[model samples]
Target: MQDEKGILIVLSGPAGVGKGTVCNALREKNTGIEYSVSATTREPRAGEKDGVNYFFKTKLEFEKMIEDNRLLEWAKYVNNYYGTPIDPVLDTVNNGKDIILEIEVQGAKKVKERYPEGIFIFLMPPSLSELRTRITERGTETQDLINERMTVAQEELEMMEYYDYVVENDQVEYAVDRIRSIVTAEHCKRERLVEKYKQIVEVE
Candidate 1:
C-alpha cells in the first residue's frame, strides 16, 4: 500500500440521523483517520481555542478568503461564516493521513465535486418516524423546526444513490464497525495499490 497519500472520507447524512455521534465513536475506535477541523467567523465560546477547536477568523478575513478562493466549501449560516480550509485538508490527506469530513448533504456534494476520489458514505436513520423522534429528543429545535428537519431528511435520503455506501445508524457500535470495515476495504482496493506493486515489479 502507498502510505504517502491518504484517503479522503466524506461522511454525511440528513439532520437528526446522528452522523456526528457515529463519527465521534469511529474516531475513538480507530486512530487511523484524522478529523478535519472547520473554520468559522463566529466568535469563540468559552473553552474554545483557535486553530484547535476551530480556526476562528473575523468576518472580513473570511470574506477575503472567499474572494481568493481559499476555502474548499463554505456556507453562511445565520450571518456567521463557516467553511473548510482547503489547504490543511489537502496537505494532511496528501501526506498519508486519512481525513474524515463530517458535513451535511449539501457540503458533501461540493466536496465530491472538488475531490471526486473521496470515499463518500451516507448515514441513514432506520425510519422517518424514528428520525423525527431523534430530532425531538435533542431538544434543540421546536416542533415546527422538527417538522422542517423531517422534510429535509426525506429529501436527503433520496440522494443516497450518489454515495458509495450507506450505513444505518440503528446501533452505534454496529455502525462504527461497519464504517471501519469500509475504510479497511477502501484501503485494500486494487486501484489504490496498483502503482505500488508496479514499482516493486520494475525494481525486481
Candidate 2:
C-alpha cells in the first residue's frame, strides 16, 4: 500500500503549561515525529545554528517572507519576527514524516486557518493554581509578569475549545502517552487509508 501523507500536529497551550516539556519528552521517545523549527529575526544565541535551531533571518528577509505568504503562521514580539516557514512543513508531511509544531495559541490559530486538516492538540494544565505555581517556579519572571501570564493563560485556556484533543499535562510521561495514542489513532483513521486500500484492492 502507498504511504499516507503525515499529519501536522500542532501542540499549544497557555504559558507555563509545559508544552515544551511535553514536546521534548515526546520526541525523546523516538516517536518518529520531527520537530518543526521556526524562522526568526532575533539574533541567534551561542551554539545555535541556522536551519537547525531556527531559520535565522534578517528583519527585511522576514518581512519579505510575510509578504510572500511563505509562512504558515507569523507573529511579532518585542520588535522581532518569528514564524513557521510553510515550505518545510509541507515538504516534511508530503514525504510521509509526521512533524510537531510547538507554538503559542495565537499562532496555532493562524495555522488552523491555513491548514485546517492539521491535528491541533491543546496541552492543558491541571488547574489555574497549578499553572500559576509552574510559572512561579520558572524564576524567570517578576511577580507582575507572573500575574500577567496568569491572565493571559486564562484567555488561552478558553481557546481550548478550538482544538481537536486536549491532553492534561499533569505528568510528562502520561501526556506523551496520550499524544502518542492520538497519533496512532489518527494514522489508523479509515478516511486517511481508504484511498490506499482501494488501490490495493483494485490491484488484487
Candidate 3:
C-alpha cells in the first residue's frame, strides 16, 4: 500500500461562527496540521500583514490567476475577489500533513466537487441570535453593514445540509476538540488504512 495521503479539511459556515477560533485552537494543540491561507484582492486592514493574514493581490493579478486556473475556487464578494490557491494546498497535502481551509460556503462546495475525498465540515453557532450578538460584539462594522451581514448569514446557514458534519460551536475548547476528533476518526477509516495492514495477516 502507498503511504497515507494527508486529509484536506474544508470548514465553512456563516459569519461569526467562530471557525477561525476553532481552527487556531486545533493548530495550537497539534502543531503538525497546516492551515491554508487564502488569496484575496481586498486591501489589508490595519495591523494585517501581507502573506501572513492573506496573500494580498491587485485586481489584475487576481484576474490573471483566475484566467490561469491557478485557484481551486474563486468568488467575488462586495468588490473584491477571494480564492483558495491550488498549489499551496496540494503541496502541503502531498507532504502528508493535513491542510485545513476556512472558506465560504460557495468555495467549500466547489472544493468538494474538485476533491471528492476532502472532508467538509460546517461550523454553526448555537443560535442565530447568538450569532448576531457575536457579530455585534466585534464592533468592527457599522449598523448598516451589520444588518447586511446578518441577512447574508441566514442564507449561508441554510446550506449546512450539504456538509459532511455540522458542528455547533457553543464553547471554544469543546468545538476545537470535536473538530480534532473528526479528523482523527477520518484518518482511522478502514478503507484508508486497511490495505496497509493486509500483508500482516497473510500466511507465508
Candidate 4:
C-alpha cells in the first residue's frame, strides 16, 4: 500500500454521534491511519497541549491562515475558529501515509469538494431518539445549548446523503470495525491500483 498514494479517510457525522470515540479506537489498533489534528482559536482547557491536542492560534493568526488558504476547511463556532491545516494532510498522503480526519459534517463536505477521491464515511446514531439521549447524557451542556445542538444535528444528519458510506454507532467497537473494513476495501479498488499494473506491463 505504501507504493501507492495513501488514502484520505474522512469520518464525520452530527455532533455527539461518537465520531471521536470510533476514530480513537481505530487509531489504538495501530492500523497506521494518522489522525489529523485541527487548528483552533479557542483557548486550551486544562492539560491540553498545543499541536498534540490542537494547534492553538490567536484569532488574528487564524484569520491570517484562512486568508492565505492554509486551511482545507474552516468554520467559526462560539466566537472561535477551528479548521484543518492543508499542509499536514497533503504532506501525509503525498508521502504514502493514510490520514483520518474526524471533522464536522460541514468541514467534511468542504474536504470532499477538494478531494473527491477521498473516502467519506458518515457515522450515524442508531436512531434520532438515541441521538437525543446521547446528547442529553453528556450532562455538561445547558438545556438551551443541548437543544441547539440537537437542531444542528438534525441538519447535519441530512447531509448523510452526500457521503460514500454510513456506519451506525450502536457500539464503539462495531463502528470501528466497519470503518477499518471500509478503508481496507477502498485500498483494493481496481481503479486505484490500475496504474501500478499498467506500469508493470509497460503500457503507455
Candidate 5:
C-alpha cells in the first residue's frame, strides 16, 4: 500500500461534449478518484467556487506564475490564462489516490507533454451537429461565442490520435462505466504490480 503510486487520468473533449457531466458521474461512482483542479484568470461562472472548481487568479498573478514556470501546462484560452499547477497533481498521485483532469484540447496537449505516462482520455459527443445543439441549449453565450467554440471543437476532434482512449459521451452512465473499467484494467497491468510480487518472492 505504501509503495503503490497513483494513476493520472486526463479527460478532454470539445465544448458541449458533456465532459464535465461524464467526469462528475465517474467521480460519484468511484470514491477513490481525485479531480485535478485547474487555475484560470477568467471570472468564475455561476456556482463555481474559487478553489474547488478553479483557482481563480488575477492576470498579473497568473502571468507571474507563468514567468516562474510554476504551471505544468498553460495557454491563453479564450483570452484568459488557464493552466494546471504542477504541485497538486504530483502530490495527490504520490499519495496513492488516482487523479483526473478535465481540460480542453490545447491544455490536454500540454498535459501530454508534461506527463507523457499519464492516462489520456478523449470524450467525444454523439456528433458535431448534436454538439452545436448542446452548446446552443446552454443559453449562456452569444451566437458568436458559440460559433467560436464549435470551430475550436471541430479542430479538437481531429487531434484524437494523441489520446489513449476515446469514450463517447452519448450517455452519461455508459461513459462512467467505461472509464471505471479502464481504471480496473490499468490496475491489472503486470508492470504496475511487479514490485510487490518481487518483494514477496525474495521474502519466501
Candidate 6:
C-alpha cells in the first residue's frame, strides 16, 4: 500500500441529524483529515466564504461542469444544483490525507458506484420523533418544510444498511468519538498495516 493513497470517506445522513457537527469534531481530533467542499448554484449566505463553506457558482457554470463530466455526482435540490467536484477530492485523497465527503444519500450512492473501495458511514438520529424535534429546534425552516424533511429523513434512514458503518447522533461527543474510532480502525486494516508490521518484525 502506498502512503500517499489516503482513505476516502463518505458521510451521509438526513438534514438536522448532526453529521456536519460530528465531521467538524472528527477533523479537530485528527488533523490529517480533509473535508470535501461541494459546489453549489445557490448563493452564499451571510458570513459564508467562497471556496471554504462551498464553491459557489452560477447555474450556467454549474451546468457546464455537469456537461464536462467534471462532477463526481450532481443533484438538483430546491431548484438549485449541488455536486461534489471530482478534481479537488481526488487530489486530497492522493496526498495521503483522509478525504471526507459530507453529502446526501443520493450523492453518496453515486460516489460508492464510482469508488467501490471508499468507506461509507451513515449517521442516524436516535429515532424519528427525536429527529423531528431536532429539526424543529433548529428554527430555520417552517412547519411545512420540516414535515417534508421528516418524510425525506425516513427515506434516507431506510438506506442506512448500504453504508459500511452506522453512527447514531444521540449525543454529540459519543457520536464523534465513535466515528473517529472507525477511521482509526480502518487505517489499521491488515492490507494496509500488516506489511509495515512485518518489516518491523524483521528489523535487527
**Candidate 5 Cα misplacement greater than 4 A, ranges:** none
Q: Model 5: which residue pairs collide?
A: none
Q: How many clashes in each structure?
A: 0, 0, 0, 0, 0, 0
The top-ranked prediction according to lDDT is: 2
lDDT of each: 0.85, 0.90, 0.86, 0.88, 0.87, 0.85
lDDT string for model 5 (88-127, tens) is 9999988878999888889889889888878899999999
Against the correct fold, how does model 6 do in TM-score?
0.88
Candidate 4 global Cα RMSD: 2.2
Q: What is the per-residue lDDT of model 4 for residues 1-204, given as tens digits with 9 covering 90 to 100?
A: 227899999999887898877888988999999999999887786677898878999999999999999999988754678899999999999888899998888888889899999999999999888988887886756788788888888888888999999999999999989888999999999998997887877854
Among all windows of 10 consecutive residues in model 5, the one with the lowest summed lDDT is 1-10
Q: What is the alpha-carbon lDDT of model 3 when measured against the actual structure?
A: 0.86
- Superposed by TM-score, candidate 5 places the C-alpha of residue 87 at a distance from the truth, in angstroms, of 0.7
* Rank list by lDDT: 2, 4, 5, 3, 6, 1
TM-score between model 5 and native = 0.95
Residues 3-69 of candidate 2 have per-residue lDDT tens digits of 8999999999987999878988987899999999988898886677898868899999999999999
Candidate 4: where is the Cα deviation over 4 Å?
Answer: 43-47
- Of the pair 3 and 5, which is ahead by TM-score? 5
Model 2 lDDT at residue 129:
100
Q: Taking the tens digit of each residue's C-alpha lDDT, what string does model 6 give over 53-74?
A: 7899999999999999999888
What's the lDDT for residue 31 in model 1?
A: 59
lDDT of 1 by residue, 41-134 (tens): 8777667789876789999999999899998888764357778889989998889889988777877888889999999999989999899999
Shift of residue 83 alpha carbon in model 6, Å: 1.0
Give each model a TM-score. 0.86, 0.89, 0.92, 0.92, 0.95, 0.88
